[model samples]
Target chain A: MNVTIIGTGNVGQYLIRFFSKIENINLQICGRNSNVLHQFAVECECATVDSIKKIDTNADFTLLAVSDNAYKEVIEQMPNVKGIVIHTAGSVPLAVFGAKFNRCGVMYPLQTFSATRKSDFKNIPFCVEASDTDTLNKIHKLSKKLSKDVRFMNSEQRKVIHLAAVFACNFTNHMYSVAAKILESQHIPFAVFQALITETAKKACEMNPVLAQTGPAMRNDQSTIKSHLEILESNADLQKLYSFVSESIANFKKQEDIND
Target chain B: MNVTIIGTGNVGQYLIRFFSKIENINLQICGRNSNVLHQFAVECECATVDSIKKIDTNADFTLLAVSDNAYKEVIEQMPNVKGIVIHTAGSVPLAVFGAKFNRCGVMYPLQTFSATRKSDFKNIPFCVEASDTDTLNKIHKLSKKLSKDVRFMNSEQRKVIHLAAVFACNFTNHMYSVAAKILESQHIPFAVFQALITETAKKACEMNPVLAQTGPAMRNDQSTIKSHLEILESNADLQKLYSFVSESIANFKKQEDIND
Candidate 1:
């Protein structure tokens, strides 16, 4: 299959690297930035295009890996093609491609992408969505080649998935930042918490997260929570966060009790 | 050196397993549960005690790995003679041991403990706190045998360290739980978001978390945030949490911008 990827950012770069390794897939990398396009092309030994207008219509798949803001503009600029057009977005809808394209779908990889970090796509889940049965099958086949975990999901489903990702990945990491900042204020090294952080994450993965939950909030050790809040009192932001999250956890625990 | 582990919970089990592997240490495992004591003693080939009164003070090191509520009772029950008495707690103070014994300190392994899940202690940080220099050196040497990452910290420092850990690990995992719950409500498999969660965590570890922060909250995409809130509105607790955390991230981002 011939695959043309638009946008040479982290996502595009990673997809290029991943797809380049697939023996049967012929890859073409594209981005508005000529420098990045040339750079990725040189690195991957794949064809590079500066604009979507130059995308090959004969290609089997055209993947719009661009930013959410640039989706409509990029899709509008792409050459009139009969090949399947897919956007690798978690939040965007498939209908954005319009009825003009031969096929439209989403191949959203549920993972953070970065140029330097190599991801094991085989373990990562790819949420696939298509407007038609044939297009869906094609994307599903491609998804299976990359990962063992794949699911057929529509725009609405993808949106919920994206929201969940924000809570699990994005917000979780933000909490880490909050912790780091607190430690930084006290001149304590963040490395002190690395082991604890990693192990906590592994536990959540191993069991139901609710069961894995711990700390003062979960235990309802008001004394300890109060002491912690006192320590964080100087930082109003953290204080607010502490109260909010602690209350939420407490409420969840209470709900669990009632259910039981 | 003789080591008495005064709790047969997760930490106690790990310590027994760890110390049992080392040739020089004499292990004494104690717990209130007779069956648990018998099981650990038979499996680990160590001495077991059902009562705290059975604790031998002649040991080179006494590790109190009990729950917070049971710590004081266990400590009070220990025999008079002592070498080094240490507690594996994050919040408990070193001074709590007082000058009642010859040597007292802390050997807090900064990680979530679970019997089923085996952790590689080689890299996990052991925060060693001692009342005096000689005791500190002894604990540090013992820590070095198990882990490469060992640091001398005071009770005050450990308190802050625990607080930071709550945010980084415990709170972060809760965020993941919230994410999983959201996805579950939508009839989506939580496994689909694993890739994004893993990558996001890996990225935060690679760089400063604050710099790596992204999402509608960080971007101040109020429309997206509003939509997400609407999805979570039925769950009032979660909705409130979402709003508060989003607002906190926005404010933090603003502060970061100002600092820059």
Candidate 2:
């Protein structure tokens, strides 16, 4: 099967590298930047193009792995393909394809990607959606080749998952950033929290995150809360965040007791 | 060296199991709950005492792993120990030791523990503090046996680290709980985002958490943000948290650009 992956950003590059490794697959990679695309092509040993128009329509799977904003421009001028087309976005709906293409779907790989590190997609969950059984089955058969966990989700469900990804991955990452800054100010090495962060994620996955909760806020330890707030007093945003999250934890704990 | 552990909570239990495995160390376990104490004693093969008063002063180290509120009450009547005294609380200050003991220190292990799983202390960060070098060195030497990352932190710095733990561990887990709830409401399996959560945490630790930040909030994609808010419109607390964190991320991104 011929698979064309568009864009050269993290997700696009990741798809290119991942699909290149699979058996019985022909890969074509395209991006707006020729220099980077050329570099990536040599690095991943795949075909590269400057425009989607250059992509042969004979490809079995065309995956648009571009940025959310660029999706419109790319899709607007995107030539209709005889093959199944898909976008690898968490938030972007499959409807963006509209009637422009007979067979289009979403095959979003539900994981964060970065060019710096190699992503192992074998165990990653792929949230796949399409307009019909034929397109979805094609996406499913293709998705199963890459990931062990593949699910069919509607647009709203995918968006919900995306929002949750924001809270779980993106926002939680920001929380880590806040913590790093707090330690950085005191000259504490970021290494101190590495094991804690890993273990916290592990515990959350093992059980319900609500049950895995710990620390001062969950315990309603006012003195600790006061101490933390005092330390964060200078930063208005952090101070606000710390207070709001603590209150939420306390509230959750209370509800937990009532439920018990 | 003889060690006495006061309490049977998760931290205390973890310490009991961990320290029991070390060579050339004697363990004494105490707690108010006899049944739990008996269970732990049988489980860990240590002497169990119902009162802190029953613990002898001959121990080389005595660790109070009780809750924060109970620390004062337990310590007020805690027999003066010839051993180094320490508490495992993240927020509680070492000053609580006062003149009550000559070698009082803090040995706050910077991780969340649960009774369900065995905690590996080999990589966990142990934040140590003491009134003098002799005590500090003794604690540090002892800490090195269990963990490679032994840190000499003052009461204030330890508290700061503990506060950051709240954000990085407790708050991050809460975010996962929110994500799970969101997925549950939409009839989607929580497993869909497990890889994303794990990858996000891994990325956060590999580099600066600020640089690892992603998602709609980081992008300042107002459209995506608005859609998320609409979905969370009913939960006032969640809505508030969503906006507060998104705004914080956007503001941080702005500051990052300025720094660049």
Candidate 3:
């Protein structure tokens, strides 16, 4: 298979690393940044293109891995293609390609990615959606080259999954930063809470997440909640979040009681 | 070393399991219910005490692993100890033991525990605190038996850590439940997001959490945020939460821009 990946960002670079390892695929990497593109090409051992226009016109597929904002412009500017076109965006929909391309799809990897961090895609879920059956299957088979878990969803469903990823992956990660900030202010090591964070994620996955919930917030311990709020006295944003999340947990616990 | 554990709850039972493996520790497990206590005794091969009164007075240390609410009453009721009397509640202050027990401390394992699920404590952080130096050292050394990362903090510091734990562990787990609930309503498997959750946790620990952050919220993409809010329109609580957390993230991103 001849595959051209546009955008040498984290998702694009990682895909280069992944497809480079595959024996049969001929992969070409493209991005505007010549230095970054050259580095990725050398590192991942894939062909590099200075512009999307230079991408192989006869390639079997085009993996659009640019920023969400760049997708529309990139789709508009890139040379028209007959091969399968797939995007590696979370929230962006497949319809963005519209009738412009005969074959197009979405190939969203629901995990946090950064240009510097090397991530394992083996168990990561690839959300695949396409304009038609042939394109969907092509994207699916190709996605299997990188990930074990692949699920087919339409535009609406992928958006929902992306929203959930925001909460599960993005928001959950920000909570770690929040905790780290709190600890840093106190001159405590960020690691003092690392085990707890790891355990919380593991336990939620192991059991029903609601049942796995614990802490003063879940129990509605007003005194502890008040204490926590007091600690966040200077940060109005944190105080608000602490109150809202605690109230939500308490409300859920109450609803569970009524159901019981 | 003789150790008596007061409470047969998840933390207590897990402590029983952890301590059972160590050869030199003579362990006694106690709780209100005989069936449960006897069951733990039979399963873990530890001595069972029907009440705190039945625990041997000569024990080197006593672990109070009961719920936060029960700490005050349980501490008052437990037999006076010459050795350190430690409670496992995170938010509860070490000052709670002052004037009550000559030797008292805290052995808070910073992880969520459920009675049914067994957890490995080898890497979990134990936030140890005590009323006095001798008790602190004793608790610190004992904490090593259960976990490698043993941190010493004062009552105020531990309370702050506990507060931080509520954000890092409790609030983060709640986010998983929230994401799962959204996906569950859409007939999508919660397992789809499991890899993302695991990666988020692992990545946050590996790098500076704030720097590791990603997603639409972090980007302040109003369009994506609006789209997500539209999907969550019917659920007011979720809508409120989604809006608040996103706003907080956007605010943080704005602050980061200023800093940069």
Which candidate number has the best TM-score? 2
Off by over 4 Å in 3: none
Residue ranges of candidate 1 with Cα displaced over 4 Å: A24-26, A76-79
- Model 1 clash pairs? A110-B196, A111-B196
lDDT by residue (B1-260, candidate 1, tens digit) is 89888888878888878888888888998788888888877888999888778887688888889876567767777788567888998888887776678788899988877667887888888999898899999999988888899988888888998888888877887898888888887888666665676677777777788887878798777767878887777888888888888888888898899999
- Backbone clash tally (model 2): 0
lDDT of 2 by residue, B1-260 (tens): 79999988999888988898998888899888888888877877888888878897899999999988788889998987887888888888998877888888888899999888787999999999888999899999988988988988898888788888888999999999889888889888777777888899899889898988888888778888998899999899889999999999999899899999
Which consecutive 10 residues in model 1 chain B have the weakest lDDT in total?
A: B189-198
Q: What is candidate 3's lDDT per residue for A221-249, written digit by digit as tens?
A: 78888888998999999999999999988
Clashing pairs in 3: none
Model 3 residue A55 CA deviation (Å) reads 2.6
Per-residue accuracy of model 1 over A1-260 as CA lDDT, tens digit each: 89998888878888888888899888988777888877777777889877677878889888888777678888777788778888998888888888768788899988876666777889888889998898899999988888888888889988888888888977887898898898898798776776676677677777778878888898788878888899988888788889888888888788789999
Worst 10 residues of 3 chain B by lDDT: B75-84
The CA lDDT of each predicted structure is 0.83, 0.88, 0.85
Query: Can you write out model 2's per-residue Cα lDDT over A1-260, one digit (the tens) per residue?
Result: 88898888889878888888898787888789888888877877888788888997889989998887678889988887899889999888888887898889999888888778897999898989998898999899999988888888888888898888989998899999999989988899888999999999999988889898888888788877888899988998999999998888888788789989
Pick by TM-score: 1 or 3, better one: 3
Model 3 lDDT per residue over B99-153, tens place: 9778888888888888878779988888888877888888998999888889887
Q: Please state the error at residue B17 of candidate 1 in Å.
A: 2.4
